[model samples]
Target: MGTKPKTRFGVIFEGAKRELFSVRELDNGDLSIFFKAPPFYDFLDGRSEKTLEHRYSFHRSLNSTPPAITLMRTVALEGGQIIRTSQLRWRAGESFSTMVFARACPTLRPEHYIMKERPKDTVILLYPIDIGRTTLFYHVVVTDTSLDPVIFRRSGLWVTSETFGHFKLVVLSGFFLILPFHRGFVSHAMTSKMRVDGQEIGADLPPIDLGNVSPERLLIDIGRMTTLLAEGLAERHISYIREQRYAERFVTETRQLLSLRPVPTPPDLPRR
Candidate 1:
């Protein structure tokens, strides 16, 4: 065993665990990852004819929601350290407008929130979570896990799970987590309180008033809250192990599996 050859591994989500993609480690030590969209996946609707790059554009043209999902996945893959994400709107005649939210963080920082607003287009929120921050989220109902595998589960009050680095989250039943609300944008929810787990982490936390805030601002605040928690969890464990590399050998080894894998071809989406 010369040098014990460094091996590449990836963590698969429960849904994508099936062979919907291929992973190749390149000779230059980067991975070439190819992902095929499965049938009935929302991203495939109406945009099947588009290439990967154009598909992003096509999806952005119709709805801003799908691309945000993509960005969130990308952020998670990058260990949840997201500085900014862009939202683009397609205007008539193929014209596009873009909004950029940016932030610069200093090293060894404490938890804080910063807001920058551009009345017409952009709104920037920067909230950085310190290391070892843990938040315990409360949910009112204890339903089955069918809602979303990435977030909720059916287990009778499971303790907590790790996502990225130091973002450790625990969900409790009969308790609802109250998220911030931006005025005139976000629909109201039966409000509840969310607390941090340890005294050293989330002591004397302020309450979130969902009554009168802008939608963009609320989004930034919630996003920052989530980012900080996920960062804390990422610090706790090594979750994202796969990096992009082109591996000729991996392609050869998994060729049969790739060949037999059924790529999803969803029916044409309904005309908008």
Candidate 2:
């Protein structure tokens, strides 16, 4: 009888030359490395299939030990999908997920969570704060409370990567749950403004090139801001539905929206 191959760990990434590479452990504990040229698809133009070629092989070895790879599942927006794979779940720890719903009041179920499929052009990243709560960062605002009845505004994080080309990596930054009406002697409001060291930023400013900034320094800034935001939310004592409900609803909706779409691809290099 033939014996099954032992499992091992490895890493995978998309190369600059439009190739997919993998470094995985062999049955005898040795490592194997190789690359594959993905079928041509105009990902930027969205004319072809969006299927990703490379994926984490963890799902294939369900009976393995120590889990060949650890992964986190995220919603489809912000470059996440309901599909299971390593690359999609690669940054699971760093990634957060949430849903925005129109809340009629603090003690009532949200009418329904808001949904947006094409958030790449404006949304940067999404940060999970808590169950049913998230933070979203925006470069542009196509739909706001003024035009539509969006009670909560989820914050998303934005980052740059070589594989994605001009397309920014969007992640969960935080969540903003809006109450339909003032609930008590206190209230809060959302703004399209930001400040660095007390210097206010204009809403019409262009997106910053992340390449020129130190990731550590930027993270420090984001952390401080996120802390402040959380503290402020706590102070407000805004009561709303918590996680279990939100999570269940989120998962169900995400699955329903899953479809074979073009795998998000990198855009042309940023102009020098």
Report how far off residue 106 is in candidate 1 (Å).
29
Query: Which candidate achieves the best lDDT against the true structure?
Result: 2
Task: Write the residue-wise lDDT of candidate 2 on 1-272 in tens digits.
Answer: 44322211111111111111223333543222221212222333575433333222212223444222222121122233232212111121122211111111221122212222232212211211111222222111111112211111222232222112111111222223422122211111122233323344445443322122233443454444555555454445433334577546645644543532422323431111
lDDT at residue 164 of model 2 (Cα atoms): 21
Question: What TM-score number comes out for model 2?
Answer: 0.23
Q: Name the weakest run of 10 consecutive residues (lDDT summed) in model 1.
A: 179-188
Count of steric clashes across candidates, in order? 27, 32
**Model 1 compared with the native: what TM-score?**
0.17
Whole-model lDDT values for every prediction: 0.23, 0.26
| Whole-model alpha-carbon lDDT for candidate 1 | 0.23
Q: Which number leads on TM-score?
A: 2
Worst 10 residues of 2 by lDDT: 10-19
Give a tens-digit lDDT track for model 1, residues 137-199: 212111112222223233322222212111111222111121111100111121222111211
Off by over 4 Å in 2: 1-109, 116-163, 172-211, 238-272
RMSD of each candidate relative to the true structure: 24.9, 22.2
